[model samples]
Target: MAEPQPYESALDAIPGAHPYPRSSRYHDAEVGIHTQPDGTAVRYVKRRLLPPLGEADEDIATHTVSSGERPDHLGQRCFGDPAAWWRIADANPVLDPRELTAEPGEEIALPDGFPGGGGRFGR
Candidate 1:
């Protein structure tokens, strides 16, 4: 059997790339290197914006819903408006509104249509 190749850290994988400056709010930014088997290397920078704590917490709540849970139910429970299901559906572009349903361990975006807007539950 062939021995498994050792995994390389992101920093080791890329050359001439350093961690983002501390002054930058996005600490997760890093340089990524892609190399061909023959050793030709290409470097690229990647940056990710971490979500706020509130959004993170809400995402956790969204993940707790079961696969069978209805989208309307999610809207009602999270936003206090069952009709706001459309907003939730809209935010989750990955899922189709006509087939909105949560799967186990899936995180869904919470709808932000709070009463005064023209959104589903808007006044």
Candidate 2:
């Protein structure tokens, strides 16, 4: 396993300020502060580049989308946590997760190593 990268937050200098939660997709993304001409500070998250599908390694799994199945539902059915939908998103090429199941019978790739395994899709 690759060593976990250190997380640095622009808000870290502020007392009691915390970065995005671990469950958030942007949790590992960097935050930047831009100072406007009016002397106002605007904080924004840096663009996050999606990891290549190969990053999931050789343990990839597949899921067939069913009617009314959403990313969160797939996350819950595969990883036992609705918030883990991002993991599925990371494994696929969809820019918007909702499109992952917009068409029934569509197949999407799932990364391994998550809880609950990636076999069931709540069918």
Candidate 3:
């Protein structure tokens, strides 16, 4: 087998290597952050496949909420239905469907199934 190449630094191992931001808004030492000219920041988090704390594995979900998008829009994008707002509501326990609103740059959990249809619904 060929010899493994030594990483120059921790950042080199990452797929997209970019300089850390000066603001340190989302910098986690373990994970790197990338800043955009539009004043938006993107965080690169690292997690192992296996459970980190206990024997049971955990499900960690991440999402970026953009401006002018309601829960219904996200449901439609993920599950292909605007009426399936419950998916978004359920994912975001802090949110109220009656007055749904998502802040830009806010990350939220995406529902498993919203517009529950496709394979089963067709048949």
Best by lDDT: 2
**Clashing residue pairs found in predicted model 1:** 67-102
Residue by residue across 1-123, what tens digits does model 2's lDDT show?
A: 232355433455455465665546776688999999999999999998776666656677777888988888888887678988888887788889898889999888887743223444443
> Tens-digit lDDT track for model 3 on 17-72?
63343112123236747889998898766541211222211232446777787876
RMSD of 3: 17.8
Superior candidate under TM-score, 1 versus 3: 3
Ranking by TM-score: 2, 3, 1
Compute each candidate's TM-score over C-alphas: 0.36, 0.69, 0.39
Clashes of each: 1, 0, 0
lDDT of 1 by residue, 73-116 (tens): 76666556666565455455544664556356666555343121
Error of 3 at 5 (Å): 53
Runs of candidate 3 with Cα error greater than 4 angstroms are 1-60, 98-100, 113-123
Note the Cα lDDT for every prediction shown.
0.49, 0.72, 0.48
RMSD of each candidate? 16.9, 6.0, 17.8
